[model samples]
Target: MFKRNKTRRRRSSRQRGPVARAFFFLVKAGVWFVVLSVGWVLLYKVVPVPITATMLMDPNGHTKDWTPLSRIDRNMVDAAIAGEDGKFCSHHGFDTGAIEKAIAHNQRVDRRGRGHIRGGSTISQQTAKNVFLWQGGGYVRKAFEAWFTVLIENIWGKRRIMEVYLNIAQTGIGTYGAEAGAQRYYRKGAAKLSSIEAARIAAVLPLPDERAVNGATGFTRRHGNTIAARIGVVRRDGLDACIYR
Candidate 1:
């Protein structure tokens, strides 16, 4: 009984207070950091600030650095709407139908150990991720992105959302947005882009910061033509007509 009591006392002594408190404080701080980071991500996309590339760099060192959506051409807007989210103006932040189809497709692929991957994330969701969070395929980041996306959609509306996305989205190494991208790619202002020029810009959206618009590569040319072809349809349809009207 005495030996048992001595052992118990020794174990109690081993559990010190300072180390435990420090560990507790660290955990608490970590939780708050995540909360704040997520909050900042949500705010950054909705608010207009010339956020210098946090993840990617602008390599070209062009003089026309930060430009606004008002400076961008209608054709560029049309091309972007056609290529990325055809339903941008209509959806209420989340696209239930598209998400459902994507889920079904993913399941089918998963079962067979291989299949074509599908993504139903809308322009808002993409904006949320690009503006606030890092790029990757993780459930936690995606979940947070979805939450922030909802926040922005509810507060900013279509015009502001598009505005933020256009400004912040990386167009090249150090270049960002249609305005900056236009100058970098074509040595022209965004407001002056022609249909074909706008299409070329849209073609590089998926591979921003890497793909060159003036590369003279077949892939770039072909993709540019494809985007150009779709511009007429989007323009005639109205940018938000499908979703809004």
Candidate 2:
């Protein structure tokens, strides 16, 4: 009877070994992920992010000059907020309303059997993707994007998110950041960009590779004007107060 009991205990221990190992592995991975993410966020808080996946993947090797938020033009900030995410300052990391709207729009378009699907990623989400993750539409990439977005929102704040977004966003085919984009197109510094110029820059954000900041025409011009108009609305309504202050 004692030998039988010992055999049963051994069997139980063997059964539990893999489960315990798996659990410990998961815990270690989670701890490492948290530590590494926190360290990366803290590093970028001061140092200009040297490179992004997008920049590295660019065939021509893009140009980027890291300019601080204080040095960047307020109009550019307003334009970005207006053109990309009107509720940027209000939303924490994700924009549920925009996501819902985009979902509804896509569903409607799907039902019609024609039209491109739209994305509802906010500036914070975009910054998280641009800075940490690669460009893609898979569930895995999106999951990582969400994780990093939450981290940056909690650790970096709205100002840092905006600053990083403006600095890392793909402004042109071979241009990265507002400074490079401004100099490449307008022959001026990012800090010196006017509202209209900034609006034009923001107008190309949806498809920066295909659009031109200097050669504004048709939809680009109209969209830029619309963004310029909305900038005042966002400012007056305090939608940008979180970072502007």
**Which stretches of candidate 2 lie above 4 Å from their native place?**
1-16
Residue-level error in angstroms, candidate 2, position 148:
0.8
TM-score of each: 0.71, 0.90
- Best by the lDDT measure: 2
Q: Give the per-residue lDDT of model 1 (tens digit) for 1-245.
A: 99999999878756858788688789999899778865775576445654544444434553335556667777887788877777787787778888899899999999998955777888898888877677778999988788779777876677777777777766766666788778777888889999999888888887766577887477778978888898898878776553334
Query: Runs in model 1 with CA error above 4 Å?
Result: 1-47, 52-64, 97-118, 241-245
Tens digits of per-residue lDDT, candidate 2, 1-245, equal 99999999889767877879699789999999989988998898878899999889989888999999888998999999999998898888989999999999999999998976888999999999999989879999999999999989998999988999999998988888988889998998999988888999999987888888887898899999999898888889988899867
Cα lDDT for residue 78, candidate 1: 77
